[model samples]
Target: MIPTDWIYGLIGGVMIGAAAAMFLLINGRIMGASGLLGGIIDGTGKANMKERLAFIAGLIGVPAIVYFTIGAPATNVSNNMLVLLVAGLAVGVGTRMANGCTSGHGVCGISRFSVRGIAATLIYLLAGGVTMLVLRHGLGVI
Candidate 1:
């Protein structure tokens, strides 16, 4: 029998893609989570505070609901406080520098054929691949 995990992932991907497409079509704005959250927190989203709030709510709420209904698999998240802090900081810096997160550039932007998004995606993928290669393989961390 096929593993349920792959099925769940496929379904999740479809849902995310459809949601992103619908959000863009209905709202006429790119659905970038970081931008949405950052704007609301920094007051830049004041113009569409309601919309941002709803989006953010769904982002957090749906997962919580799913967890209650169907618990998630165990994660391999790090327990090291310093590593976690550094990783979080690095992601923040990287996202700010890139102007969007992977979902924004990869899923939404790529689907729309956005040049900036394409370039940003390529750069980040390369960086991430190299980092993973070094950390997981070269250093034999894994």
Candidate 2:
């Protein structure tokens, strides 16, 4: 039998793809979460505040709904506040540097055969693998 984690991953992938497709089809724009949030923060998304808010709401609300409905699975991630804060800040900085996050460059961008997206995705994947290898195995920090 397939592992439960694989099943969960598949379901999550489908949901993400569906949501991205819907956002693109309905709004005629790529669904980059960072881009959306950045717009809101800088007042550039004033023209589509409702749309951005709805997208943000879904990002937060869906996970919450799932947690309330079926309980959350054990993530096995570090609970250290410092580690989490650093990781979050790193991700934010990385996303800004890359112009998008995994959902954008890795999913939507790659799906559309964008050169920048593909390049960014490859770089981020490589960096993540190297970081995990170093931090988790080499230094045992994570």
Candidate with maximal TM-score: 2
CA RMSD per model (angstroms): 2.1, 1.7
lDDT comparing candidate 1 with the true structure: 0.86
Candidate 1 residues lying further than 4 Å off, grouped into runs, are 1-7, 140-142
Off by over 4 Å in 2: none
Q: Which one is best on lDDT?
A: 2
Q: List the pairs of residues colliding in candidate 2.
A: none
lDDT of 2 by residue, 1-142 (tens): 9999899899989988998998889888788988888788778889999989988998899889999999987779888999999999998777877789988998999999999999999999999999999999999989
Clashing pairs in 1: none
The estimated TM-scores of all candidates read 0.87, 0.89
Q: Candidate 1, TM-score vs. the true structure?
A: 0.87
Global lDDT of each model? Answer: 0.86, 0.90
**Candidate 1 residue 73 C-alpha distance from true site, Å:** 2.1
